[model samples]
Target: MADKTLTSANSVLLIGVTGLYTVPQQLQGFSEDDMYSMEAVDTAELKMGADGVLSAGWIPQIKTMGVTLQADSDSNTFFEAWYAAQEAAQEILYGFGSVTQTSVGKSYPLLRGVLSSYTPFAEAKKTLQPRKFQIKWQTALGVPI
Candidate 1:
């Protein structure tokens, strides 16, 4: 029988920042939708000429990655602190991170990542909602471990 692949077990997401948070730590406190999602901002644009000619222009854009975690997660607190430090810094500090799916032996790395957007906090009457964090990354295709 062929080897059974395609598993999410033993996957981890880690983040780090220079001078502030140099050590990369695993981000926990994830919600049910804990999978990290990545999407390309734009692909290629194509046009057809009147004389039945075709032209295409490929635009290289940053990839946007998003993750959802519980509001009360320690990971959220770490992110908040990281953001605060960035805001208090004299210069911008980009984040360095990586996500590895050990089961598949595939890893996605973020060379230079910017925390594009995130919800500080949100709460209902007696319930805590999950917070979403979006990151803009300049990443290439996933490589083998």
Candidate 2:
């Protein structure tokens, strides 16, 4: 049988105002999805004109990505500091980076973006759940091996 384990996976996040912040660990992946997922900001739409003509149009949307990391001390500290910095700076500190799923031999490019949302605190019964955040990136295309 093949080893279906995630051997080496990491998400390297590079902030514009600061520097690179590498999450040196596997992400919290969904049961029926990839480790990292990309979603469009707006879906394409089709409109019917008065003359029964179909017109399709879509806003040029820069894809957004969802990333989850273990909410350990390190992650909590780093993100807290980052959030504080962003708040103090009073500016949109965008970022760019990549996610490498070595086991699957696939990589994703994280383009210019900022942390759209972040979960500062969440707790369970004697368990530190992963911290899920959203990144609104200009582009996030998958590159298969």
Candidate 3:
């Protein structure tokens, strides 16, 4: 009974997880008419050197769900190569459900906060900035029983 479509890349991955859990609380609740229609364009002379410091970029935020399923593409390349082959191996063992262990034991407890490095790339789009978020969950009778 869970029929869903919602594409446009799933509405840009649900607006990148609601702008990565709300843009740093909306830049710390800025007010006074939001700093008078906001305009502060002096990015230190556009952050020069080293190709404008790699094009003067910034976007950081992340909170684990194993770094959002390792920046999913159905969890790191098609359900992890069909959970490591054997001819679609019972469809990746009934579509991934039981592989757990993390009290620092680590056996894919949803990839342990994406291999932990204090995850943040617009809240775990796996550190590829310029806005990022991704999600793809499928069951519709692909077994979860």
Candidate closest to the true structure, highest lDDT: 1
Of candidates 3 and 1, the better by TM-score: 1
lDDT of 1: 0.79
The sequence of per-residue lDDT tens digits that candidate 1 reaches over residues 75-141 is: 8976787678878884657788899888777888776778888688856557888888887877736
The residue ranges of model 3 lying beyond 4 angstroms of the native Cα positions read: 1-67, 72-75, 79-94, 102-145
C-alpha displacement of 100 in model 1, angstroms?
0.5
For each candidate in the order shown, give its overall lDDT on alpha carbons.
Answer: 0.79, 0.61, 0.24
* Ten contiguous residues with the weakest lDDT in model 1: 1-10
Clashing residue pairs found in predicted model 1: none
Candidate scoring better on lDDT of 1 and 3: 1
Q: TM-scores across all candidates?
A: 0.85, 0.66, 0.16
Q: Which 10 consecutive positions of candidate 3 have the poorest summed lDDT?
A: 10-19
RMSD of each: 2.2, 5.0, 20.3
lDDT for each residue of candidate 3 in 47-125, tens digit (9 for 90 to 100) = 4676555344553333222213223223233323323442334322222221222222222211111211222322435
